[model samples]
Target: MPSSAGPSIDKITEGGRVTQVGEGQDADESAPPVMTFGAPVAGEILAERYELVEHINNDSAGRLVWRGVDVVLRRPVAVVMRYPGGDSATEMLQAAVAASRVVHPNLVGVYDAIDEAERAYVVREWVDGRSLRELVADGPLDAGRATAVGNAVASALAAVHATGMVHGNVHPGTVMISDDGRVVLADARTDGADSQENDVRAVGGILYHALTGHWPHAEAPLHGATAGHGRAAIPDAVRDANGAAAAPRQVRAGVPAYLDDLTMDLLDDSVAPPSSDVLAAELARLDVPADDDYLDSNGPLRFAAEPGEEPSPLAAAGGRKVAFGIAGLLAVALIGLIIGISTLGGESDDPKTDPVAAPSQSPSASSAPAAPAVRDLKISAARIIDPDSRNRSEVRDAEKVFDGNRDEGWSTETYPTSNFGDFKRGMGVWIDLGEERTIKSVQVNLSAPGASAELLTGTVTGQSNESGDKRVLDEFKKNRIGQPFEEHDGTTMTFNGFDADQKYRYLLFWITELPSNGNGYKVGVQEMTVQGS
Candidate 1:
């Protein structure tokens, strides 16, 4: 609760809940539920003065989740940044803190950074809710929620761009939602080749998914190529994907025609229209049918242009609303398709620069802009919460425990069960990382062996996964990990990088020897935790 200084937990218990002393934690209606990850992070404390709740991730890059404590304040909240135990964690934390200065409401807050004894951590105001990824699967989000998600994230991007930062990872997975359906932006640390335009393209991609209930990986072009020297060039792939939408109106019916037009317009150019702040202004002012309540709740925050520019776009747009849901809509896919694996390679702990997705040749006509453009959304940033960028050295586990009940615990909904689990065990949960990072080691403690499956491990590189001009990373994980959940029977395994460029976020911990598979021992995982790169 200190402005320049943060606090530490006196006696935070494992999986316990803690309250924050601030407006964000005012009431149940106000605070989103706390999500945590298990395992005692700090030393042996009796009752977690701090509580941790776990949430499921739908991105290719694997991220561990948690909430921390104010030992001095005796409160608890969310922290978003790579766990500092892994290699490159230091550099990653530095980048995360640099970007954390980016403040906006629709965006989640970046509280403080704590680094102790050479370990690091990043904390923020926890949304205490779900994500857009979750809402899409629950059923098409009501139009209000959808628009809120779009408009809010746009506002967040505007702030990010205002500070010259970019949210490189912009999938449905990065947006966080509240219990009552408030939207917050997650992963403020997207770096390297991250840019304002990519963030815009991601917004378009998000809008497309919200409306259609389909997860779209825009086969976006990086200035025309994914090879050397071209990745920095903004890609029109998102626009191409938006344009490729079979029926914009048909997919979600009520989307204002103009909104669809805007999304499509975003995709058309290889580069983003302008800085996110500018684009945000455009979002604020663009004309829409009157009486749409979603946009009204989003207040007009100041757009940061000096003296004066043209009228704000967001003001004209009438403040649209967008809902937050974290469980991805298409986790359980009946129709399968392979996606290009992440080209950012090397599992070494060192912060080797992420291989920028090379810009493509013969760039789209729209991307040939004279300069870097920022959007004119003009929407003011929402107030999530934040602090100084101090990297913390501990991780708090999710307060909610996995009970093996498919509906309640873990992200069964996000990752899906029945078809996804291969159905051999009682319930199975797995994550597929899109990029490869050095995994120092992993430990799986089963809650109960009865339903546990064998945790399998393997490696896949970008070069190995690439096929001609395209790469199918999803296919590499599913076929390589999904199909053979049964092959990995026993215990621990160590695997290395799969590419000069890594292909996926994480290696699947598949279950091959389920009790149903006749061993009768059952597959149980009390905890599946990975430590450091």
Candidate 2:
């Protein structure tokens, strides 16, 4: 299990009812005996399948969270149990059933929801990770990472909303980051008390908490097992005398003005929040290179508006216009428009295909031919390549590098020395662009400086077997595409040595040296993006 900053405590809320469980607390003496009598014991099997292995904690709402095992499936699971279950656990069970219906990569999988006459328990996927609340316990996240988290949460909510369901819970505590760098949302309430709009606004609160380490919505306290035991775990948002929460940039330095504007706009109820999908798209656009001071290459992010609705003034005020109207069109259409104009004059002259029919080109378009589009290439799939490792587990989460998250990533096991403890040569990530694409630059974001890496390209056999992977690895090693980046001093590395005329399908980012991490050494690919059409 991932470690927490303090003693673990969980706050669970259904509808308007809130329950809190603290460490080392006994059941209340004055509470009903039925609530305390049916507490599950370690090794007890429920529904003849889930065996409780450990009592993790309890919530104030008189519910228990147990780390258990699905004896039949031999997989770890989290069993949340409430006593005297018939009527009291209806909302919880209903939420689990609803969440189970809509599957998403960022959502915790719901396995079973069972209700006995005396007690009820809901089984869910056990995450070997910590919550976002724990992550921000120390301090705020950088703009890039916070954007990534917000993007993930928005995406999850978008998935849920698509099914006409509301994930009533969207707070830091419910957002989980696994050991292999998967961001998952867990514990949906699904009670009718919350609306989809509230869920969208909660993402803003999540962004605020991530970037500023402050919970903006006082109505929803930061949920933590250890909260309220002593000093508050997370402080309320800093507000002026006028009662408006301060922007993230004001609370912390280095937060990009555009990100600050987007977050505040979401939290502003007067200015309607964009739909979950729109918010996800906007955040994905902002999840740029960590080293970038601002979004220059990708331009600004614009929140989508209703067909006739005007874009929010907050979005346009900070020079970070939401993706709407001419601005959005220019970013995507300009390249194609310019390309078409250049090719128009080159086409074989025919009276049927007159130059007058062509779209009016920019004044400078006639001066020079347009450049080919060099946008961010979408990675269809990615896998870690540890051809030399004893176990193949290191290759489990290669997608993390391309998951648009700079904070969570695929990391190598720590070694006593920088050179993989002399156990193997090195490891890397292999990315497939689905189809051959015009070669451009590849940007690799590392967790630390001083790592050495090289860029290589090769063709992938359609085979999905080990022999195919080995062949790909061999080709990558033999046909290195660019010069090796040796002992890079910075965390961001861009390999632009690819021949523009050549097309590439499979590319390998091979790391040769590890950066110093504590007394040992390890390296992490926080984010990797290939730039091409």
Candidate 3:
């Protein structure tokens, strides 16, 4: 082959077998045959073009996969290689060339295939993510996510089957979930192991595993097909005494009847499987729009703060501007009383000259503290924010943090595991004070101890939570108050040392890290108090 960058003959690891670039199957000496030739060292250039970066995974057929970079193109690729002089090597190269001809967004793109006398290799696109096997290992996916994944796989199969070819391999290991939430089917080993019907059946199996967290094809040879302890595991399809799989809805509560029927029909040997295109269309119908199913938490309120700091005043007035007008009327009435009192006091002893002098000093007196007593400032509105933009939940209950009730507070849904389920950066509750006001300090209480959080403040320019708090940090130029509290267990988050009379409108109480709640992770704010009258 002509050299794209350099021409070298270094063996690559198992290529497209695993969805992610660098993950390998569990180490098992009894596993299927792997490459007999020694593994390639890091930095070794293969075909003088693809430089070996890291070893990924060994395929079930025993090919070594590698993560490498195309020196000429400067793009990442996966290299699957085997030792020279075998029917398997020839089949691998031929399969790569064949797959390369079929281009689809859902299918992994093959770049090059070469078979030297010494070794055979196939270079393909690298997906920077985990396989479906890894994703389902944690637990079952939600209905919407499961449907979306199934639709992607079915669509990919529809294209491949249309070209008069077979994917041959459609197991979880061949399905990839990109880091950016894209779903792609990869690693087609069309060595005639299975027919197009088998691929269609596999899509049903994917949906089954996602909906139930149990691979109904437990007896199959696919990696991650069965759980440990010799148990079949929890699945929507229950195995009968004779090992027959039951309908999905029969085993799971939320599985819709139509989805349950489709899943079982595909798996049933007696029933003929639908064509890939037909199946793809059906799955598409079953799939709910992710946005519609998972509504984002409400965003921050846009209007300026209502005039009064009393709790729920904005809620009662039904409109922010109207409430602000009411508060303004109250403020004017209070000013009139103060002026009457000051005038009455000034008339004492020397009425004329002192009153004029007092009026002149009033501007200087504006610098003095307005109020001595600390009050609970009402939070008119709030929204939930995920810095990674992945965890957009909890908007409806966000105002509970300021509901003046410790018993009822706001909380994020429990993630699969702490660290935002390993998929999100962080989550926060952005509180809107209706309008800017002097902030003395804020007290925050959490449901549990040991979670980490920070007090962030920003000024609202136009509307709050309009863009889902995307510009909040930019608005305030990242104004952070107080050191981040890492050991917080429902303690008050006091935001002191703020300019005494400087008005601050928007505040964000962000949770950077969450403490373990035993069943995955959940963090809640029991109460939030803003003290400034």
User: For model 1, how does the per-residue alpha-carbon lDDT over 88-148 read when each residue is reduced to its tens digit?
Assistant: 4665466567656866556666656654423345566765554554445455553334555
Q: Rate the local accuracy (lDDT) of all candidates.
A: 0.41, 0.73, 0.67
Output the number of the lDDT-best candidate. Answer: 2
Q: What is the TM-score of each candidate against the true structure?
A: 0.41, 0.52, 0.49
- What would the per-residue lDDT of candidate 2 be over residues 1-533, giving only the tens digit for each residue? 11111111122111211112111133343553354567778899998999999766555455787789999999999888888788999988998899899877778889999999688989988877667776677677766677777877888898899998898877777787665556678778866888999999999999999988888876557443344543235678888888778888667644555677788988998888889988887876666444342312233456644565554565444223233335756866988888899897568656446666656767876666678888998788887776654233345456568766688787776566777767677888889899999978999999999999999887754333345556677877777877899999999999988887889998999988998876467788999999987
Model 2 misplaced stretches (Cα beyond 4 Å): 1-34, 222-233, 289-297, 304-533
RMSD of 2: 16.2
Ranked by lDDT, the better of candidates 2 and 3 is: 2
Clashes of each: 145, 9, 17
TM-score of model number 1: 0.41
RMSD of each: 31.2, 16.2, 14.4
**Model 1 lDDT on a 0 to 1 scale:** 0.41
Clashing pairs in 2: 9-225, 10-225, 19-60, 19-61, 20-60, 21-60, 302-322, 302-323, 303-322
Per-residue lDDT for 45 in model 1?
Answer: 28
What tens-digit string does per-residue lDDT give for candidate 3 at 1-533? 11111111111112233444222464344653555554567899988899999776665455678889999999999988777635658877778888898887788889999877567788999887668767776766655677777888888898889899998777666778766566777777656878999999988788887767666776663643344422213333467788877555544433543456677777877877878987776666545444543343222211112446433645543354465558767988999999999877757555446645444556755676555677778787776665454323244466567655687677766555556656655677778888778788888888887788888887754333335455664554378877788766555566675777578888888887777776456778877888785
